[model samples]
Target: MTRIVFLDRDTLPTRPFCFDFPHDYAEYGLTAPDELAARIAGADIVICNKVVFDRAAFAAAPRLKLIALTATGYDNIDLPAAREAGVTVCNVRAYGNESVAEHALMMMLALMRNLPAYMRDVAAGVWQNAPFFCHFGAPVRELHGKTLTLFGRGNIGQTLAGYARAFGMTVLWGERKGAASVREGYTPFGQALAQADVVSLHCPLNAQTRHMIGEAELQMMKAGAVLINVGRGGLADEQAVLAALKYGQLGGAGFDVLGQEPPRNGNPLLARLPNLIVTPHNAWASAEALSRMTDMVEANVRAFVAGTPQNTV
Candidate 1:
């Protein structure tokens, strides 16, 4: 029987796994760095979401044949090490497009309309004690007639574009930064930033894309433009973003990720700001998306066992 071990089952909600083949399955709610090697030893397959599987861990799992990822990102796993160890790695994809797009849209709408500021006023009785019939403090903006620039044209970006279009906003696909030339359907990076009323990022995090947005890029954007990031935390410089928000360089900003998970050390962007919104990286955790991701993980495992691996990364 094939042995399958899920090292960090607590990262995701409880979901049923129905593997067709005979297997010895084991799972733990959470696994720390020191406990990883021993738990995965002698396992033929390993399933995980955020657990790191470095070269040393791969060496310890001598019988590991597959690394099935429940999330779309495979950054936690060392692909080169897995390849050397003959471990086929697969990741689920396109399972959270709607969920993530909706989250991004929600952030954009809330920021544009100054929802947070109004909520605070309501809670503080500022609205109840208003001298006038209505209280209008923060400047509210509408999505219609604004230009939205998207850094990625993948599933989530495309989904967001459709939603933006429905609100009568013009959409622009931004070409990669420092490219020799712009793609057919993409605007040059700098030009996109200058023209955007709102900017959304959906690109993956890698060496080439890390810290892609910083002081220089922020300066290139319109003074009152909104920035939305549902992608990886490392994609933008959080310190620079906080500075931009503080000085009114940016009208507002929204983020669903940070450079560090849990941010145990604290992050500058966490400070209370009327124009800033930060979620605990739950953009892809909607019930529908979680179910779809679970189903995709099962498919990847079954495909790998049948000698026809799919969604390999």
Candidate 2:
């Protein structure tokens, strides 16, 4: 029988797996760095999300044949080490498209309408003692007649474009930064920033994309334009964003991720600002998305065992 071990099962917060093949399955709610090697020892398949597996771990797991990922990103795993160890790696994809797109849209609408500021005022009884029938403190902007520029043209970005179009907003796909020539359907990077009333980032973080948005990019944006990031946190410089928000260089900013998750140390973007909104990286954790991700993970594992690996990364 094949031995399967899930290192960080609590990350999914979903239903238990139902494998079709005969297997010895084991799971841990959360696995620490020191506990990983022993937990995965002698296992034919290892499933994980956000667990870092280095060359040492791969070397220790002599029986490991497959590394099934619950999330779309496999950055946490060392792909080179896995390849050398003869381990087949697979990751779920497009499962969180709708969930993440909706989250980004929600943040855009809330920031543009100054929803958070008004809710705070209402909670403080400011609305009850209003000078007039209504209280209008912060500037409220509409999505209609505005330009929405997207950095990535993936499934999530396309879905967001459709939603923006429904609200009468013009959508533009931005070409990669520092490219020699612009793509057919994409606007140049700097030009897109200057013309955008709102900019959303959906591109993956890599060598050329990490810290892609810094002081220079912020200065290029239209004054009082909103910035939305549901992608990786390392895509933007947190200090630069904080300064932009403080100096009124940006109308507002929304982020679902930070450079370092759990942010146990500290982050400049964590400052209390009326124009800033930060979510705890739950943009891809909607019930529907989680269900799809778990199902895909199961399918990947089953297919690998049947000698036809699917969703290989």
Candidate 3:
């Protein structure tokens, strides 16, 4: 019988997993770094969400053949080590596009209309104490006729563009930064930043994209523009964003990820700014998306065990 170890069970719901073939499987609610080696001992396959699988972990589990990821982002895994060890790694994709895109739109609308500020005012009884029927302490804007610039042209970005157009907003795809010539379908990066009323990022994090939006880029953006980041947190400079918000260079911003998970080292973006909204890295955790992801993971596992792996990366 095949033995499989799920390193971090709490990454998903506590419901039972369905597999067509009979196998020996073990799951832990959470797995600490030191416990990784012992927990995955003697296992042929390992399933993980955010657990870091480094060289040491791979060395500790010589029997491991497949590493099935439950999430799209596999940066946490050491791909080079896995490849050297002849271990197959697979990831699920496009399962969270609809959920993440919808979240991006929601953040855009919330920032555009100053929803957070107004909601806080209402909660503080500022509305009830008002002498007039309506309280308009902050400026509110409409999404219609606004220009939205997207940093990526992937599935999530394309989905968000369609939603933006439905609300009468114009969409512009950003060209690669500092490219000598702009791509045919994309607008010049600097120009797009200057013209956008709302800017959304969907790009992946890598060497070129780390801190892609920093002080200089923030300064180039139009005053009072809203920025939304549904991509990796390291894509934007958190301190720069905080400065922009304080100086009114940016009207507001929304982030679903942070540079550091749990912010154990402390993050500047955690400050309670009236114009900033932060989510607990859950933009892709919607019920429908999670369900789809689970199904895809099962498919990946079954295919790999059948001698033909799919979605390998």
- Choose the strongest candidate by lDDT: 2
Model 1 C-alpha lDDT per residue in residues 9-90, reported as the tens digit of each score: 8887957788999999999999999999899998999999989999999999999999999888888899999999999999
Question: Against the true structure, what is each candidate's TM-score?
Answer: 0.97, 0.98, 0.97
Tell me the TM-score of model 3.
Answer: 0.97
RMSD values for the candidates in order, in angstroms, are 1.2, 1.0, 1.2
Worst 10 residues of 2 by lDDT: 267-276
* Candidate with better lDDT, 2 vs 3: 2
Instruction: Enumerate residue pairs that collide in model 1.
Output: none
Best by TM-score: 2
Candidate 3 has its poorest 10 consecutive residues by lDDT at 13-22
State how far residue 299 of model 2 sits from its true place (Å).
0.5
